[model samples]
Every structure is written in structure tokens, then in C-alpha cells.
Target: MKSAILQEADAEQFAEAGFAVLPGLYAPAELAALLRTVEQAPVSGPNFRRSQEVFAIRDMVGAVPALWPLLDTAALRQLLGQLFPTGCQLVKAIYFDKPAGSNWLVAWHQDLMINVSQRTDQPGFGPWTSKPEGVSVQPPVAVLENVVTLRLHLDDCDATNGALKVVPGSHRRGVVPAAAIAELTPEATVCAVPAGGVMLMKPLLLHASNRSTGNRPRRVMHLEFASVELPAGLAWREGKRLMM
Candidate 1:
């Protein structure tokens, strides 16, 4: 059952499973506002990807300032407080949609890269890659460990509609080599989230999704939060610098 309040057990579950789902984080009105804002986003832009199966805005926070009103709320703050008692900042945001009839399939992988403002020759950070989205680099394991990703669904999602399949405790293994993902995963559980639900997870968790077998649109706003300070001379991409 989903709770309107974020309880301590939610934090405990997340600590153990590396993921937790809080259903109905957004009310009807809030979700409607978000959908309306999404309709205004540019159909084609540098940060937008409109493939046959997938449509995504890599920098939703920067591209659409109207999203903040719908995203920032007391409920969100409560959830964040339970997980990060000290503090945390929203470091990244991406919005993606799996349209009906979409055949897009994502392979099992850990989100090990982070978007940063500059390429600092830090001792541990390296293997930088630049994309239209932003400059990305694989930070230290500790930095990735500190990341909290909140996936808010704009439509109902289930195993039939490209819901995420995750390895329960894989995050504890630290960063797994991408080259060794042949097994995809030994075991997995489908993360079924309702429309307006929010699923929180660790960036290190092993996750993948299959092509949608059902005819439902799956849209999500992927938000990443972190409190750790990047090594000197590094900062998050623009619009992710705010504390929420």
C-alpha cells in the first residue's frame, strides 16, 4: 500500500532494496499541470530525442521551468527528508516517454555516469563523454552511491508496458562492469508504478526494461538528487544547481 506520508520504513526499504515506490505522489491537478507543461516542450531540440519508440528531453529542468511548480511539494520534501536527513540537491532531470507501439528496449545497466558543468581533472573522476544532453563523466563510486533517482510516472506502468526490471540487491555489489551484462540479470522484479506514482532508487541499482507488449504510453520524469560535493572545479549541469 502507498502511504501519503513518507515513513521511516520507506527509508529502510530503500536502504535494503536500493529502491522504493511511493504511489500517487502527485494529485490529479498536479499531474494535469505537468502534462500541460509537457505539451509545450519543443518537439525538436538539441536535448530532445524523438525516435520511433522513445521521446525524451534530457534536460527537462532547463528546458521547462514550469515543471518546478508541479514537482516541488511538501510530500516530496518529506520523502527527501526521510532519505537524506542532512540535505540533498536536485542534480539532474530527464523526461522520457514510451509511446504506444514503441519497440524500444533498454539493456540491463547501471546509471554510472553523471552530468557535470565542466571537466575537472580530478583524481578519481574521468572517462568523460560529451553529448547533446551535457558533459558526462563516471564519478567515484561514492558519488554514485550518494545519488538518489526519483522516477515519476505520468501514466500507469506494469510489466506489459516497459516497467523497470530490477535486481533487488545488486546495488550493494558496487559498480558492475558494463561489458559483463550478458546475463542481463540472474533474478529480477518488475517495478509496477501507478500514474502519478514516484519510484525512488539508487543510481547504482542494476535495472533494465523490455519492449512494451501492451498498448499504453509510459512517461516518466527522471530526477536525480545528491548532497555530496563534486571534486574541486566540477558542478552539475545548469538548472540542476538548485536545492529542492
Candidate 2:
């Protein structure tokens, strides 16, 4: 757990840059242990082709007691509270493994929608109605506002292993114009971090990753949090809440 003063500083950084990196958030041995647990999980079917190699563990706080220490860590809790003061709950947990030779490349886009469990034409639910086999729709602004993402690096991430690239202060703009983006400079700041470090980002921030050009694999644990209440009769599938 970090001190209150450190947590405040982290929150400020997140607000200014739309992201923050906390080094040594986890010990090397702790990270290695979680990585092993992730490796043992069953992989989804072939249709799960979103990322080159990815897996998800819902309610991970219950699955791995080791991670509970992280959740209870004062710094993390303060950051979460600062982001979602109302009381946020874990929405979903994902593991991304960018293997050598993987050609996966993510585009610059905002996490606009969240597919809840069962879909409805609820007020803040989506432009889409039902949850496709593996696809989900975007959630309303209320939901988006309550969300914060934590990405933990399991290996030393640099430009070679497809470290995340983000547009500084981009989150201040509600949405980016495609044509404007096309005309903008290609400059992007790389988020480089060593193993056991963590990156905290806003869901609306513009970010992406490229294919791994390095020999080693890049692994990350992405977790989302939301503080708002779920709609009536709807439950969050994984971290996705069902809207009424």
C-alpha cells in the first residue's frame, strides 16, 4: 500500500495525462505468481480472435487471494475512490499475451461501449441491443464516467514488445475527429515500464498497441472498475453490467 500523499499524487497524474504509472506496485515474485495462474487458465475458442492471445478471469478478486492485497492497497483504493468516489466494483479482468510474431495491432479508439450480460434498450446501454456471441455494445456516458482501467505489465515493456502508445491530454477531448487525427502528427508517447509496474488510465483515453517485434512475449493484466449501480434485472456478465 502506498501512502496517502503518494495516492494523491497518482490521482493528479491520472487527471493530467489521462494515465499514471506506478513502479514496483507488485514484487517480481508476486507478478510471476499471477502470471503462472493466468497461464493455467483455459483459453477460449478460436472465435475469440480479438487479441493475438488473450484470456479473461471474471471477479478475479475471488479467484486469487494474492491479488486481494493489491485491491486493499491504500494507494490503489485511493486511486479508485478518486476516479469513482461513489463506490466502484470490479467489472472485468483480462490477460493479454502478445506473443512473438503476433501481428495484432490495436487502433486508437475510446472504450465507448461495454456489453453488459443480457442486453436491453435501456437509457444508457447502447447503440446495439443484444450481446453478440463474443461482441458487446457500448455503455452510456454515465457508465463510461464511472469506469477506470488498470493495466499491469508482467514483463519489461518497451517499444519492441508493443508497449502502449497514448496521446497525452487526449482524454480532455470528448471524442476525436477521424479526419483531424489523420492530419495530426504521428508522434505518440510510448508507455515504457519494467516488470511489476502498473499503468492506470481512463476508459476514454486514446490509446493503442502494436505487434510485438521483440523476441519475448508481452503480457498484461487489464482490469476495469465501475461504481454505479446496475440496471434492474440485469447483471454484469464478467465485468459487463446488464442494463434494463
Candidate 3:
């Protein structure tokens, strides 16, 4: 977790493969506590529609006191610092659950935009339009660059249970064309991880998941962070802050 270690291996992985999966990032008891919290928390948003396939609850860190320790852990903080030496702040947190018999699959895409607090013609922000789905079009590069995500796995993951698939080194190219991806290798690598492992990935990386054929469930706590700076008058939602 030292800066030297992270700079040598973790940062290299992020730059070359767009992600890094660090095993045993969380203790077994901690993982169990997180799962329990998710099971009891209120379900909200479109993420809850397919409870068996894809169920997500937001603001988990603030809701679960047990998880706050991870925020200050020396190893984790050092890794984050190495990942973003400039400084970073928590942007969002959510618990993602993929239950058995779940056929939810996410298509390959980039996390290139953010929901603005208000409408604006800001040059680096967006196409600036609202939609029924509540998602805005392409936001500025600065916003995307400031963001990073941590996906902590509470259960073992494998291809049978829809482990994440990502294109190595995809983040460097920015957003990839859908047609172009079809021609590239379907070499979707399976991210198999034991319980208590964590996967850190860039928001722009091309990643997705497949249906779960195994009887087990895949539970993950996703925590996203970004630098404090915002364009002009934009602001992050309250209670989203989880990091200094």
C-alpha cells in the first residue's frame, strides 16, 4: 500500500489495463457486514427494478459505520493517493448485487458524463439536455478525468457468475466506437476474485458483465471518487462526500 508500491504496480495497471484487482483488500468480517447492510437497506432507483439481476442501494458508506474504517486505512489511502496524486473526493457510493439466475448484462461503454446539478451551456460539461431516463449527454473531459472507482467484492466472482470483462488498455483511447469494439477481440477476460477482494478501475474503461449461470450471488460495493474542483458553478450532492 505504500506509494512506491502503488506507483510501480497499481498505477502501471491503471495506465496499461485501465484497472487493477487487489485481492484481500477487505477482511472477511468486513465483507459480511457490508452484505448485511445492503440486504437491510432500502432499495431505490432503476437499479432495484430487477432485484434478482441488478439491485443497487446508494450512500452505503454513510449508512454503514463498519465501512468507514476503510476510508482511513493506510493501505487504501496510500493507494488512492498514488492513483490520484492531485487530490480526490468521494463522488458516489452504491451496493451492487447480482443474484442467482440473473441475466443482466451491461453493454460495453465509457463513463464519460455526469449529471449536472443544473442546466448550463458550459463548454466542457455537456450537450445540456434532459431526458426521461434522467441522464445527460457527453460531459467535459475534465470531469471524467477527475473520477476513479473502487469495486469491493463481497462474494467470490467467476465467469459463471458474471465477473466483469474489460478491454486491456482501453482507457487511453477515450470512448471507443461501438462498431470498432465488435471488430476487436472478444477476449473478455474474466475477473475472478475471492471474497474480500477489491477492483479499482478508471471510470472511462470499457467494462461490462454477463448473466449469472452459477447458483451463487455476486455482491459488490462500488465507491467512486473525484477531485474537489467543479466547473464554474456546479456542485456535488450533499452527503456524497466520503473522502478528503
Among the numbered candidates, top TM-score falls to: 1
TM-score of each: 0.93, 0.79, 0.83
How does residue 33 of candidate 2 score in lDDT?
73
Task: Provide the overall lDDT of each model, using Cα atoms, as 2-decimal numbers.
Answer: 0.85, 0.68, 0.69
Candidate 3: count of backbone clashes, pairs at least 3 residues apart or interchain: 0
- Please give, for residues 23-90, the per-residue lDDT of candidate 1 as tens digits: 98888788889998998877777888888878888778788888887798888887777667788888
In model 2, pairs of residues that clash are 88-227, 91-239, 113-138, 113-139, 114-138, 114-139
- The model with the greatest lDDT is 1
TM-score: the better of candidates 2 and 3: 3
- Candidate 2, poorest ten consecutive residues by summed lDDT: 46-55
List the candidate numbers ranked by lDDT, top first. Answer: 1, 3, 2
Please estimate how well model 3 matches the true structure, expressed as its whole-model Cα lDDT. Answer: 0.69
- The worst-scoring run of ten residues by lDDT in candidate 1 lies at 235-244
Number of clashes in every candidate structure? 0, 6, 0
On a 0 to 1 TM-score scale, where does candidate 3 land against the true structure?
A: 0.83
